[model samples]
Target: MKNILLGVMLLLAMASFAQPDTAKWVRAFPVTDYMVDISDSIRLVQVELPEGTSFKEKQLGLLKGIYRDAQQDTGTIGYGRCHLIKGHYYYFTINHKQSGRKPKAEDLLYTMMDSKPVYNGAITKLASHFIGLQEVGGSALYDRYQVFLAWTKTDENNVIDSIVSDINYTGSYFLQSDAAMNQQIKSGRFAGKGVLDVMMATGKDEVFKFLEYMAIKPNLYAGHEWKVAEIFATWLVSGAPAVIKE
Candidate 1:
C-alpha cells in the first residue's frame, strides 16, 4: 500500500511538470545559410525559440564583469550569462553571438545553473530548456560539435589544447585499428574488414576539418574577440550533436 501511494504521488508530480502554457519568456534568432551548409560537418542544428524570457539579472551582471576581466587578462574570448524562467523552471546560456559565423571556445559558455546535473545532458537540451522557459519564438544555427577549449595563463599548459589533442589521438588510434584490420583481411588473416575501420575512414576527415574551421573562423563578437571565442568554444564542446551508435 505504501509503495502504491508513493507511485501515485510521483505520477502526479510528473503530470504537473507536463502542464502547458506555463512558459513565460523566449528568444529566437535566424541561422545563416552558410552555417547550414557546414552543419553536418560541425554537427550543428538550426532552432527557434521565443523572446523576452526572464533571466537572472544579477548573475548576468557578474558574468559580464568576469568576461571583462577575462578579456583584459587573456585577450581571448570570455564568457557571458543569459537566463530563462518558466513557471518553476530556470536556467542560463553563457553563450557567444556573432554576425556572420558560429562562435568559438574563445567566446561563449552555454552553462545551466539552478539545475541538477550541472554540465549534464546534451547542449540542445540546455537550449531547448531556455526556449521553453521564454515561451517566445526565434531561430538560429547551432553546431552540434563537441570540442574543449581551456584558458590558462601564458606559462601554463593550455587545458583546451590538451583536450583537443586527446580527442585527435583517440581518433587516430581508431583509424589505425581500422587500417590494421583491413591489412590483415587482405592478407587472408581475418574474416573481413571490421565495422570500426569503416567508421573511422568515413567521418574522420570531416570531423577534423570541422574542428579546424572552428579554431580559425570561429564566430566573433562585434568588438570583443575573446568573448566570442569563449562562448563558441563552450557551445562546440558541450556535446550538442546526437551520438552515432556503432
Candidate 2:
C-alpha cells in the first residue's frame, strides 16, 4: 500500500511538469538567414525551434556557459560561446537588448548568468529534482532559441578544422578521451594511416593557427592551452566528426 501511494504521487508530479502553461512558456521569433562562425572553418546557420517547444522557468533549471551577441555597429557576430553541457555540445547566442547591455566590442565571449534552459527530454536530468535543461541558440530575441544540433558534411578538412578549432576555443578538448595518445606522441611510435599520422601532418599548422586565435582573443580561458592542444590534436587525428558519439 505504501509503494502504491508513492508511485501515484510520482506520476502526479510528472504530469504536472509535463503539462506546462504554454502561454507563459512559449514564444516565437521571425527567422532570418545568416551565418555565425563557430571556428576557423565551421559556420552556423540559424535553425528555428519546433512550433511548440518551450523554455523551462528559471527557478526550475539553469544552464552554465558563454554565448555570442551581435555587434551593434557592424551587425556581425565576431564573438561567441560554445555549449558544453555535462557532455552534449552546442553553440548559443542571446539578444544583447534582452541582455541589458551592448556586447562590448573588445569582448569576444560572455559567460551566461541566470539563463534558463530548454524544457526538453533530450537533456540529462540532474539531482535538482527538475527535468533536464538543454541549451540552444539562433535569434537573440526571447523564446526564439532554435535548436543547433543538426549536421551535414561538406568536406572532411572543414569538419576536422572546425571541430579542432571549437575544441580549442571552448576548452572542451579536456572532456575527450586521449585514447593513450600521449604515450604514442612522446615515443614517436605513430603507425601510418591512423590518428598519429593525421596529427603529424596537420598538427603544426593547427597549432600556429590556434596561437593566432589566442592572440586575437586574449580574454579566452587561461592556463589550459596545452591540454586543449592535446585533446584537439587527437580529434584532428580522428577526422573530427560533427557529432561526437558517447
Candidate 3:
C-alpha cells in the first residue's frame, strides 16, 4: 500500500510540471467550443493594464510593445514594420484639374488658394507624415500615374488606442506567420530583408498593445483625398525618420 502511494505521488508531480503555462491559447481570439494550447497555429496573448498600474508601468508597457518584435535585433538602431509614436493625423487633399492627359511633375499642385501662402512649406508638411512610398499601378508607359505615400502624424500627442484597430490589422499571428512571410518575400528586397519578416519566419509574433497594421488611404485618382489621415505628434522609431521619394 505504501509503494502504491509513492508511485501515485510521483505521477502527479510529473503531470504538474508538464502543464501549460497559460489557460488560453491567446487573448486576441478566444476559443469557445474547445480549448487551445500555446502551440496552436492561431494563438494570441492579450494583456490588460491593471486598474492600479502606475505611470511608469504604463510607459514601460509602451516600450515593451514597441520593441516586442526586435528580440533578436541587437543594434540600438530601431526599426520595425510599425514604429509608432504619439501624434495626431492632420488630413488634407491637394486636388488639381487633370483634363485628360497624364499630369506632369509640376501639375501635382499642393493648394487651391492664391490669396495667402496656402501651400507654403507644404513639402515639409507632407514629408513629416511620409512613411514610405510605392508604385502601385501597372505599366510605365500607360496607367502608372500616382504613387502611394504612408506616414504617421506628428501634430498632436496621443496613445495607440486612438490610432489603430482590428479593422486595419491584428498583428498577424497564430498560423498566419507563413503567409505573412511569403508576402514580405514577394515584395522583393524591400521586405526580403525586413526585420519583422525574419521574426515572423521564426514564429515570433509580438503582442500589439494598442494598434496593428497601417496603410495609406488614397483617392480614386491615386492621390491624397480631400481628407487627411491623422496620427499623433510623438512616435517610437527604430531608426531615423523614413522618407518616401517620388
Q: Which candidate is the best by lDDT?
A: 2
Q: For candidate 2, write residues 72-112 as lDDT tens digits.
A: 32232222223222222223333333223333222222121
Candidate 3, residue 120: lDDT: 16
Across 1-246, the per-residue lDDT of candidate 3 in tens digits comes to: 355335334432322221122221100100112212223222112222122211121111100111123332211111011112223211111111221121121111111111211221222122212222221121121111111121122211121221222112322342265454322322322334433333223211211210111222111112222111112101111221232335
Angstrom error of the Cα, residue 172, model 2: value is: 23
lDDT of each: 0.27, 0.29, 0.20
| Per-residue C-alpha lDDT of model 1 across residues 47-82, encoded as one tens digit per residue | 222332223532321111112334442221212333
Off by over 4 Å in 2: 1-54, 62-158, 161-198, 201-230, 234-246
Model 3 score (lDDT): 0.20
Model 1 off-target regions past 4 Å? 1-54, 57-157, 180-212, 215-246
